[model samples]
Target: MSHQRYEADLRRLFAGFPTGVSVVTAQAPDGTPWGMTCTSLCSVALDPPTLLVCLRAGSPTLGAVLDSGSLSVNLLHQHARSAAELFGSGAADRFDRVPWVPARHGGPHLVEAAHTIADCTVTTEQAVGDHTVVMARATQVTSLRRPIPLLYGMRRYGSWAEDMENGFLSYDFIS
Candidate 1:
């Protein structure tokens, strides 16, 4: 298959698997903040509390993360769609438009948009295709609010709805 064909096919395949939204942030050596919206987050292990996130290769955010050896993973809430788009847009002034503070590990924490924040230290990284897979060890995890996750799949955004009768979470579509 051609690269384009397989790429589009893989995208369609993953679109059937919904995932939560997150923003990975890092502080450059010169104090510049860099971040991007990411959905390729996975838990690696619970013994050491490790997680992995995939970021576009050569992005400033990825560079900062590798340079500083530290990062903050902000798990965005349902109300944080604007932040998700802002960070995903590769806008130069993304930080200026959002309210954030330095996390305990020195990475930027989205104050208003995140339901949880995980401060981590870079453990390992590997290049794969057009992205870099970063494995980090969680040093701290702060739960700022109840989890009403922002979801992305099917080429759009969505959220979780409470099943009032069963008190369970269910998928709710949004434009």
Candidate 2:
């Protein structure tokens, strides 16, 4: 297969995997807030409460996080596509159009996000190509909204609804 064909195939393969969308935020020096839309966040452990987030090496938030020594992961709801787009944009004043409050960990937390996990100090950073995997210890967590989580599938945002089972298989099945 040719290089172009390989690239297309890789893209198609990745398109099938769904992921939860989140906005990772931190405050830059001079009190400027910065954030980026990311889907590369994952829970690494529960014993000590750890998580990992991947960011591009050249992202503004990356530098801010490193400088400030902390960051916040805001899990967006299915209705927050606009907020995601705003943070993903290249605009300088990204926070000017969004509502947020400072977390107890000193990171900015999206006021309306479904949930937030604020980390204090990065425990480890591993370089991978043009991106870096930042592993941090969760220092603070909060739930700001009650709703279905935002999902990314086929490159779009979707919601999940609970399916209730009608009266059917029950009590007598074990007999």
lDDT of 2: 0.77
Structure candidate 2, residue pairs in collision: none
Instruction: Please write out the lDDT profile of model 1 over residues 1-175, one tens digit for every residue.
Output: 9999999999899998999999999999999999999999999999899999999999999999999999999999999999999999999999999999987684899989999999999999999999999999999998999988999999899998998999898888888
Could you tell me every candidate's TM-score relative to the true structure? 0.96, 0.87
Quote model 1's TM-score.
0.96
Residue 92, candidate 2: C-alpha displacement in angstroms: 1.9
Model 2 poorest ten-residue lDDT run:
166-175
TM-score attained by model 2 = 0.87
In the range 1-175, model 2's lDDT, one tens digit per residue, is 9999999998888777777788998877667778898889899998788889999998889988887878888888867877877877867877878888876564688887545555455788888989989988888777666755677767666665555476342211100
- Scored against the true structure, residue 21 in model 1 reaches a CA lDDT of 98
Clashes of 2: 0
Which stretches in model 1 have alpha-carbon errors above 4 Å? 1-3
